[model samples]
Target: MSHPPDIPETDAGPAATPESEESLEVLRDILFRHYRERIAELEAELKRLETRLTDPQILSAIIAPALGNAIRQKIRDAREEMIEALYPIIGQTVVRAVSEAIRDLARTLDAQMRTSFNPMRAVRRVQARVSGVSSAEMLLRESLPFEVEEVFLIHRETGLLLWHISRDPEESADSDLIGGMLTAIRDFAQEAFGRGEEGQLDEIQYGDRRILIEAAQHAYLAVVVDGIEPPGFRAEMRERIITVDHTHEETLREYDGDPTPLQPVEQPLRSLITSAQPQELSPTQKRLLAGFAAVVLLCAAAFCAGGSYLWQTVRRTPTPAPVVIVPTPT
Candidate 1:
């Protein structure tokens, strides 16, 4: 079959004319100007994301699980550097703990040794065994010679003197001030050394006199003594304090710095004075003394004849007459 005649090649539409080219260039410039700020914003956002991805925190979060072993090995290799960085912090913690522990241990051991091997305590124990009496009774008898010069019941928090009694009434004038000073000292110790509530001031000594302190939850007892305190004396004082607390629990719990609520404790304290007084010898000691006296009398009778000649010489001595003196005239 015959094909149709081929048409001559020609441009489909308008060719690249100068006016069209100029119009396209103007349009491109307008578009570029309009989107310039948005394109700049997108570029800035992309740069921020890139920087975040390179950060250690973000990078580690992304690859941590897969690179766990490698990361750990790297850390181990640089362990000396890590330790150097942390040395000051770790060293301070360990040193402080060790120092406090050693100080507490030394203080405890010193106090225990002092109480255990006291010479007066040893003597009292020997005396009790020889007399066939209880050590407590013997201690009380021995301590009776020493006086409880003063006693103070002080509030722990405010350092107020709750109650005070003194062997000499005139000495009670400064009891309140003394209690405040003791409290201040206790606070200073606790704050300076970072001691906890369990720490307390146990005693204050000046020359031959001392004030023994017994701390409780809300209050403390201070007893002034002129001589060595017997071993059982502190125990007795603790017992009395317990009794007082039990009897006055409610009043103490709601105490508002009032001294009146603790009045009842005074009677019990006075009873201590009576209990500490010296006692007479027991019947056992009296019978032993009487038997010794009878033996002495018999021995004296046996020696009477041997001393008769000496007695006769003493009786032969002459007696001199008394002389009267007359009053001289003025």
Candidate 2:
């Protein structure tokens, strides 16, 4: 029956909905773009790998190890040079991967070391600035018997050396030594901030020689004295010491109640302690101390033997009282 031509269903199915169609279109575009970018990146990587593989030396470096198994398998298969042909491919792959891994590792390590202060830029900054400069040339030479050899300034901010100035520009100092001195400055600064007592160390090793470093308010002065007489070194050091003293005096005098900018003090003897005691010990004093110690030990041993001995002897050894023990009359 030629029935009414089945009226085309006006109700568009779910697929015909505008929102559904739009979402589907968006999804398709995203997938297409993703695949295209992925393919491009993969192609680039492949091209780089191919170039690395083509080098004959890289091939040899890679495949020189799998010679036996490859040869044996190729022989059993009756191929003339199958192993030889396969070697290049295998070697190239291995070498490229290894090279990439090594390069990545090296980059990572370099970054880490920089962050951790491998070369210590703070200390280097101080060294580069003051090194080989003559801060007090004529004053250094005339005041002291020996030449004013070196001037090392430990940084107040970073605790790293700001610079090491040599009296003569001929001396070479190590960065490690500078770093160690910086550490010492930091430790001392923490310990001696406002206690009024400064710290000094005799015979601190610089590079190879021992230096008597005099720490000041914000800096330490170091002089090289290998075989030079202590008296001569001290004489030279005294001039620098006096210079530092006068400089500090002048600064304080100039400073009014107003807040003055804290200038970096180049006190060569900045670490000088007003309380440095001479270490020379007398033999007689030592002998007397020994005798006194012996007597003390004997007395201690006697007392320790029993409390009875201590009470009867050491404790009851009576002294003349202000009032004598008089007998009371009935």
Candidate 3:
């Protein structure tokens, strides 16, 4: 009864279908996979280069005498260049280690800040880590030339000595000297944090022995090591304090107060050091010079008085002798 289905117009082409689009997508996927594999190959090469750069080979065997006499010439040349380029390397070990330690501390603090919201507590934690080392004396003693008599840890912010370890059992230190040191420490810390002032020398007179004092930020760490030379300890200690200051104080806002109760200075001078300079002598030299000067002055004064007395006696007797001679001729 319905009209017969109309046949498509003879000019009309077949309709575009979803299956054709699916086929196109498959082709795109294959291309993508090919590019991804190429990218992965490039990344693997990059990783291999990075590993080689970081993992240098041990050169000992390369230069070993057993390898061959022919290579020995090359090895000798390399060693000479290295030795010249890195002079006094052992002496610089402390400076290098201290610098690395500071850098590590800075990195640790930065990481902590990124993870935590509050800077206050995070910074304090960092300070505690940086300043909590009790083994520094032990570590430094082996490398240093002289024996360490006393090692003091101080709060750089407050100029208060946090802990004092001394080797001398019989030495008693004056309280006034310690206080003066604290004052110097505070002054140094204020300057160091604010202006990077290097430090000032303040000598503490303890009877015959002298305590060489220097100011450092957040703490005046002192070694009552014997001798007059200011321990080059300053550079390493300064590096540590500066590190703590830059990392903890500026960004973290964590400041430490006089945490350790004011205790009597009980540390003894275990070692003494003096600078090696002809112009600047040790304590012994200064004392000897003073004694020598005193003896010379005394001798000069005695000679001057004796000459004066002889002159005065001759002048007084001359007139009397002339008058007597005139009377006798008359």
Candidate 4:
């Protein structure tokens, strides 16, 4: 006999009776009735968002506020990457702008130097032109003599002393303290006066002494001088700071409290003092220099005299006579 066809079992967990299905439906309505309006609003919002994504104007209107903040946050997070990527676009432009700014600054300073400030200015200017000297150089020469009293290398962010050298024994203050003070003064000036400008405080003049600042990547230098800055003082300081910054880039970037590793930096700093136009000589030093010069002259004279005597001795020496050779018997 053929077996009866098996009936399909209920796969929806358990088969609900008509009354239980009606009870579940009633329970769902009771729970969702309060949220039906809010649900409809959300569905409409989602549909509108989908539409907005396809429409540029609508999307911009929606994203403008958060988009700006998001972009800024991204830029802050990946600054170096952003810079590298943007360099191709803004690099040359920024370079040209900087060059122009520097050129303009030079011209402005030149104009200031070229202007007549004294009664004898015209005469001196003419003389300067005649002597083939730049007015800036001439003015520098005429300016009161200056001496570099101190050189300080400091961390840009923390203002901690990296290295220090001083020629002024009287004002031998703590270098770390001075560096912090300088940083404070700079911050105050920039904030109170500059108001978040791109540039920085370059010089601070106090009576006869002046502070000159040169900035680098991770560090900055402060040069204290008495009297006036010479023509090349700024350039020299700039070059020196750049050299130090470049040479010790990694060390400077990772600088800790200890500065023993940067002892070699003092040698370049020493040049600033010695390379000044005028270095006063003590009487003892002058005498020593004179004696040294005298010794050099005496040595030159002796060398000449020795050469003449040798020539005479060679002339007077007799030559060896040639001897006849005897034929060998075969």
Query: Against the true structure, what is each candidate's TM-score?
Result: 0.43, 0.25, 0.25, 0.43
**Residue by residue across 1-330, what tens digits does model 4's lDDT show?**
999999888767766799998999999999998799889999999998889999999888888999899879989899998888889879889899999987876776677677765434444566789989977666646554678888899988788999888897677998878899999998898888887568889998898889999999888999888876766779999999999999988888888878988888989988987776444556876676678669999999999999999999999999889999999999
For residues 1-330, what per-residue lDDT tens digits would candidate 3 score against the true structure? Answer: 789999767876687689988998899988798898989999999988776666646344444555677556656869776566667885599689999987876675556445644333433344456867333332332222343455555555554445555565468465335655666745665576647564465555454454544444444545555543334655544554455344334322343444333332222111112222112445875676678669989999999999999999898884644444445555
**How many clashes in candidate 4?**
0
- The digit string of per-residue lDDT tens for model 1 on 34-113 reads 69878999999999889879898987777788698776786789988868878999999999999998787667555644
TM-score of decoy 2: 0.25
Task: At residue 161, give the lDDT of candidate 3.
Answer: 48
Quick one: ranking by lDDT, best first? 4, 1, 2, 3
C-alpha RMSD between model 3 and the true structure? 28.3
Residues 161-229, candidate 2, lDDT per residue (tens digit)?
544555445556684486466567546655776366644444455554556555445434555544334
* Candidate 3 residue 152 C-alpha distance from true site, Å: 2.8
Off by over 4 Å in 3: 1-147, 169-181, 184-199, 202-208, 228-233, 240-330
* lDDT leader: 4
Point out the worst 10-residue segment of candidate 2 by lDDT. 270-279
Give the C-alpha miss distance for residue 46 in model 3, angstroms. Answer: 99
Show where candidate 1 strays beyond 4 Å. Answer: 1-127, 130-145, 194-197, 274-276, 280-330
Q: Which candidate is the best by TM-score?
A: 4
Minimum summed lDDT over a 10-residue window in model 1 is located at: 136-145
> How much RMSD separates candidate 2 from the native structure?
28.6
